[model samples]
Target: MSTPQLLMIEDDARLAQMVGEYLTQSGFGFHHALDGASGLEMLQQRSPDLVILDLMLPDTDGLEVCRRIRAMPSNALAKVSVLMLTAKGDPMDRIIGLEIGADDYLPKPFEPRELLARIRAVLRRRGEGGSDAAPAAVMRFGTLEIDRNARTVTVGGMAADLTSYQFDLLVAMAERAGRVLTRDQIMEAVRGRELEAFDRSIDVHMGRIRAAIEVDAKNPKRILTVRGVGYVFAKQQD
Candidate 1:
């Protein structure tokens, strides 16, 4: 199989070089751009399988770059995945990246091994032969609709802003509507990995998702939490 092509847009010379080297050694084909404008140009000229984008850039803002990339014709970014790389560890920053269409977010000061694992996980989730059938091309439950191709969710016909984790969690549950999924199962399916201690991260994400999709987050109807198990997607039966 051909190596996956990656585009890295980062202004930090030393860090960029180090990351590039790591990715190279991992058998990935990649190119680097030091500024946002050049990165955008490269994106338009040469489509890549994935992008590792930094928030701080010389020419253009990373958020703007993400917006522009998402605005590009589907033919341009149809199969491309974006992983936002930033020094900002703020929860809001992560939320914004996902809202702007990034597929994943990795804060800076991260271990190279973790970065590689995240990249591989994102690719695996998007690639063929996963455990579950690819999330539906379009999944609808009540007024909530999820479009996997568009990577978007809408509630009552209005677009709902969701973090990447929140979107993944909702999709995981919605795909298997009416089934109760344990917390561990939910984490495994959505995160593509096992959970560790202090993994209440999933609970936080689930809360956010419920707020976005549930008419009443305090008393959610769709995402029901079972007493001893995890949660369930209670789609009303006809």
Candidate 2:
């Protein structure tokens, strides 16, 4: 297999060098850009398997880069995963990153090991190790369709424009439709890992999913809360 290609877009020279060295040692072919413009240029020239994007770049912001990437032709963006990195840890910042089409987000001042783990996890979830026949592509659930291969979603025959995390959460629920999945279960399925103590990221992702797919997010019918247990995807009638 070819080495996984990674594009790192970070303004911090020291941090970039450290990350590049780590990824190189991990058997990845990596490239770096000091600013968003150069990063975008690199992306257009040769798409990478994954992108490590920094939110606060000297030129265009990472969020804009994500948006531009998403707006690219589906064929171009397909199979390219994006992991956003930033110092901003606010819930809104995370949400915006995801909303703009990042496959994952990590706050700054993070350990290189954690970053490596996240990259591996995202690739695994995207079905990097599986055979070609494995269903790593689109999954349909009623009027809601999730194109995992493309990282896009559609609701009631229209584009839903959901965040990457929201799409993953919805896909998880759809995969086990009509079955109650606990918070831990959902987190494991969508994030490919367990959450730390007091982490409500799952809830946030679920709420965003509900907002996209449910007619009334306040009284969600598609994703029903099962009291103390967790939640379930209410069976849709034919």
List TM-scores for all candidates, in order. 0.69, 0.79
Q: Rate the local accuracy (lDDT) of all candidates.
A: 0.77, 0.78
Model 2, range 1-238, lDDT digits (tens) per residue?
A: 7677899999999999999999899888899999988887898787887899999998888899888887777655643788999897576777677655687888888999998998888776665533243356777667777776666788787777565456667878888989999998888776665556565566676776777777788988788999888999877832
Q: Model 1: what TM-score?
A: 0.69
Instruction: Give the backbone clash total of model 1.
Output: 0
Candidate 1 per-residue lDDT, tens place, 1-238, comes to 6688889999998998999999999988889999988897898777887889998788877888888887776544744778888787567676676666677778788899988888888776665213355545998887888987666899989877664456677889988899999888887776664445544556666777877888888988888999878889998921
**Pairs clashing in candidate 2?**
none
Which stretches in model 1 have alpha-carbon errors above 4 Å?
75-79, 128-171, 180-184, 193-231
Model 1: pairs clashing at backbone N, Cα or C within 3 Å: none
Clashes of each: 0, 0
